[model samples]
Target: MMKTFLIYAYSAILVLGSLPQLRQAKKIPDQPFARKAKSIYRTPATVSRRVIEKTKSTVTVSGHEKIPDQPVLFVANHQGIFDILVLLAYLDKPIAFIAKREIKRIPIISKWMEQIKCVFIDRSNRRAAIKVIDDGVESIKAGQSMVIFPEGTRSKGTNVQPFKSGSLRLGTRAEVPIVPITINGTYKMLEEDGGRIKAADIELIVGDPIYPEQYQGIKHNQLASDIQEIIINSID
Candidate 1:
């Protein structure tokens, strides 16, 4: 219990302390913003790795070399809150997330997410959600990679949930490659024990990227199911 408290406390301090840097990076011009944001990512990445170590957990990542050089849409199964931390800490690239609108309410954390170009979607409002998708596509086309948890919520276990096909538009509309990632064991870190943090071995598997040409003619629903199956089968 104390460990969990310390983790949150430390994370809060880290986010608060990075305000000056975030503000400075936010001033960069649009043409150079992506480069500046990538450099700024190191701060959050370090903080994420430190927090994971504080939990006394081990992460085994595989197939990361499969990620392409261009900005691609990362579609991953949602296992828990730590899923984001794991990706931020371990992935060797700078990427933003398509997060829920509620997260935008977070104080300093939301500012940092905005610095990284994260798109927040209001799932309850159809028109607003469509706008969010369009914004995400533009961000991807502008050379900023993004991640989406199509399950729309954490499964809290290894049982992968069905992905909502609408989120796939970020990839299809941008004409970028779609990379499927499978995250297992994050739930045991927090959600499994009812919010108490615990030591757990986590696995993050990066499957082969599905290029635009490959998924060009497929329906979004079918594509969502295929990606879901890939994630489900990747788990132990």
Candidate 2:
């Protein structure tokens, strides 16, 4: 009973603590400086002092320099909510995510995500999904990269699940390079199946870029699988 109570308390605190940041995020504009202030300023370097003080959940990244300067599609393994925060804190470049349409309803976060030009996909509506992909392709053409979890949801474990081929089409259609990234240990930080969160070390290993040319004549589903394999192999 005591442990359960503590877990509940911890969850409540985490939620409430994030509320203020989200509230502040809503008031910010969708400009570059606003994004820099909201996303870049409250980064890994100063997050210990400003946001969550649990610096114990450290993250180490590699192959970031290998990222192409031009916009590319970043397809990574989904672990937990922590993956977003981890990337925001560590990644030097400004990138947006392909969030669900439901997240757009959240009070402050929705606004923040919108201001940052994050693409929202309504998977339930086929037309909307295609439109979202089109918008994402346009964003890439405009030199803004996007990070998408091709698994479509948190993996809830160390092993990655199958990739959804829908988002993969954005990369190929736009002729953008696909960068496969492996994110490990995030599920330990905050597993979706459970509400509780625990401090855990995180690692991000970015592999070499895979151009559409390499996958010439390959099926979209097979392309997604090949990319997922690269991410899974990088994790361990």
- Highest TM-score: give the candidate number: 1
How would you encode candidate 2's per-residue C-alpha lDDT over 1-236 as one tens digit per residue? Answer: 44435655654565456666666655765454433443633522234222223525677889999898777788899888778877766766667789988897766456556645689988899999889989888766665677889998888778899998988877888898889889988888657437566667778888899887887789989988988889878876
Model 2 is weakest, by summed lDDT over 10 consecutive residues, at 43-52
The residue ranges of model 1 lying beyond 4 angstroms of the native Cα positions read none
lDDT (10s digit) by residue, model 1, range 57-136: 99999999999988999999999999999999998788899888999889978888887889998878999999999989
TM-score (C-alpha) between model 1 and the true structure: 0.97
Per-candidate TM-scores read 0.97, 0.79
Candidate 1 lDDT (Cα, 0 to 1): 0.90
> Taking the candidates one at a time, how many backbone clashes does each contain?
0, 0
* Model 2 lDDT on a 0 to 1 scale: 0.73
